[model samples]
Target: MPNALSESRACLPPPHPPEVAKGVILDARHALVHAEQGWMAIADVHFGYEARRRRAGALLPDWGMPQCERVLHELVRDHQPKRLILVGDIMDGSGTVEETLELLKRLTESVKIICVLGNHDRAGLKRGMSMIPSHREGEFLFEHGHLPLSDHEGVIVTGHEHPATHFRDGAGLRLKLPTMVQEQISAKTQRWILPAFSPWAAGGEYTSEHKRLQTWACGKGRVWRV
Candidate 1:
């Protein structure tokens, strides 16, 4: 007879990057997956952000597509999720529709990619997440966190705050990591702010106190509650 570990974890791929908690799978490297639903999500990709910044006279290195491809490919391979949900901020305000669309063409093959537009996604692209502000599936709502949630919703997941923090290592070195923020509004409602999937969106942090928030930080190839 199969033991409990084998039976339950047979569906679970591995013990790396993505860690599960409170019904959300933080896909090990900058993504989220709801295992039961087979839906994987990423947010704040801000594709072409560096190039856009360069146009405005900022001298940043060109390091967007490689990082994006690396993480997206890894998440897709590890989880093999059904839907690839891009919560928001798919592009910086500076990027072009052509630029964003062109870059998005290289993501996980055969996965349904859903994008929810953020404030920065106002470049007037006419398809997919470019025209939408939010996506609701059953009891769950996905949106960019630039606006307040309507009072009628129950469970909400958003990205736009670019939530992150600096973590200290045993060697006294501090490195910043993306974080998932869970906030409880009441006995019946909950909110989750997924961190930025793009490495370019680092340095954002929520310093104010939220009594009910439980954050899971991604660092050193793991997700741990902070």
Candidate 2:
């Protein structure tokens, strides 16, 4: 598998020139911290993914929630952001919504949570979760990329694509890691796509033909442009 991936990578053209996010720092924990705003954001948590699969007859272990809790707790503890933004898709709509809310309640104890609902979150909304379709602050707009975004200026910070990248290590081991994508739409417009935070969500790789785009991969306790 590793050898096949390495060969495929070699056949592709080199990535475009790098673009830097001035005030946003990509977290190794599959989140982004906006230093200027004192806020941290992650997209597509998709909590209860394993439970959803198991309910459909897949014999999976019940480790998804614990893993999600650990990452989120550590992120909140480390960054101590005034607000934690869940860009979208907080629940997979198949598992127990009450269980998901329990974890969210714990998170709210430390920081304010701003949840923008995604397609998978319809159940959460019906259950009375106070979520919005979009959030705007300053020049940034936050939403789940599953819907059509209205015409807007400045940056659109969202997650729905669940961007990712694939590579092979020196030992011929193939790996698929979640990625964050930055698309330069115009001089005044940009789109920041975040990876899914759920450990079980194997996100799809980005394959756009944009001339000005940057892809950052998160894995092994490190985040780097790839």
Candidate 3:
């Protein structure tokens, strides 16, 4: 259950540098801002998901892409950061290649886009989008959490998990929410797993094998740390 204080704080616009970790700011938009580096990152956009499903006779409506674009544009407008990092899985690969490219074009016109390749991003590569293995700045290492990571000195931020948590209210209505997890691997190494930015993403439960990690649930444009 959410308290009045949490609800009210969630309603406010994102703080300029609301530090979640040492240098990370967890925005209400389900994105992370690297405060010192002037960069914003989002994961699992999963563009063209609706179109691909419709092609396969899923009877889905055309709403996901537009909604994602609107939210992305709003983030760019508000922060106007130096770069927008696509953490991974930007494309669905089933269909709608042209639409995804067009969106990238519009986004690049505003800020430089750094694409970190994920398993699903091969389609974008086939279509000629430049992507990198990982992005590193000061103390933050950004990568798609698909493969085993190498040893690094500082915080690791990854997006392939699409982390989520479930909640049941007093009325017995079950709610599944995308979540951000701050995983403390050791005293020296910490990892931040971001939620999927796409509304259609079926997120995986974020569980730790050793112990429980710090989690925050995001819903209705608001975020609550629980």
Candidate 4:
């Protein structure tokens, strides 16, 4: 049986750019950013969400497909990123690889797509990960953050927390916000945890007890609540 750590690690494809960071940059109005390094730093895109939910007989809105692709395409055209680093959970459930590949091919014209598999990306359907190398930096761990990370010497960036925040007035009218998480990889390394890029995907609220707190303790975790 595959352990959770292995399963999580399996979601990351190879790094497309030699330089892990630095490249084209696009700040999506939706409270996220993108890099020309072919990485779209959006959170919780949850592609095929409606289909998955519907397959389970759950009647919800069928709004994820067009909206998700539109945002992705807009970001891509605006930033011209050569790759996409999906922080985690690109799909909502056990998404079909055929569908994913088709969607990816549509998005990836000349760019590469690197996904740091999320809790929802079931093992059986993962295929494109093998195209890119996993664990890019030396001891630079990359995972979905569903498990505790061992103390290491390099930077660590992941998803699975699906961090989002909300602010409210005294009357309790709340406003939803997307957040960008940044942390120091070590004394020399820098880490960034991207929000879910998927619009329809649900997330583990940042304040939840199950949220990963260690990444936030180094005084480097900054939340850009957009």
In candidate 3, how many Å is residue 203 off? 1.6
TM-score of candidate 4 on Cα atoms, chains taken together: 0.66
Predicted structure with the largest lDDT when compared to the true one? 3
Point out the higher-scoring one by lDDT: 3 or 4.
Answer: 3
**C-alpha displacement of 202 in model 2, angstroms?**
1.1
Error of 2 at 54 (Å): 1.9
- Tell me model 3's lDDT, rounded to 2 decimals: 0.82
Tens-place lDDT digits, model 3, residues 1-226: 9999999987774434346766667777788986568999999998999988888899998999999999999998887889899988888775667777888988998989998988787664545678887998778888988988647778788898888888778898987889888887766777888899998986978776534467877777666676
TM-score of each: 0.82, 0.85, 0.87, 0.66
- The per-model lDDT (C-alpha) reads 0.74, 0.81, 0.82, 0.54
Cα lDDT tens digits, model 4, 1-226, are 9999999876543223222234422243332332422344554566788887788899988777777787677767776665566656666777455565567778777456666666666664476544322334334456666666546666566666665555579797975555445556356555556556666643444653233323211111222223
| Candidate 1 error regions (>4 Å) | 1-23, 127-130, 168-173, 208-210
Over 4 Å off, model 2 = 1-20, 169-172
Reference-based lDDT, residue 126, model 4: 70
Tens digits of per-residue lDDT, candidate 1, 1-226, equal 9999889877544456545455667755767777777788788888778888898899999888567867787777788888788888887775566677766676635567777878878655555334577777666788887897756457788887878877677898988888888887666777888888888877577754445568888875767777
- Kindly indicate the candidate among 3 and 4 with the higher TM-score: 3
- Return the top candidate by TM-score: 3
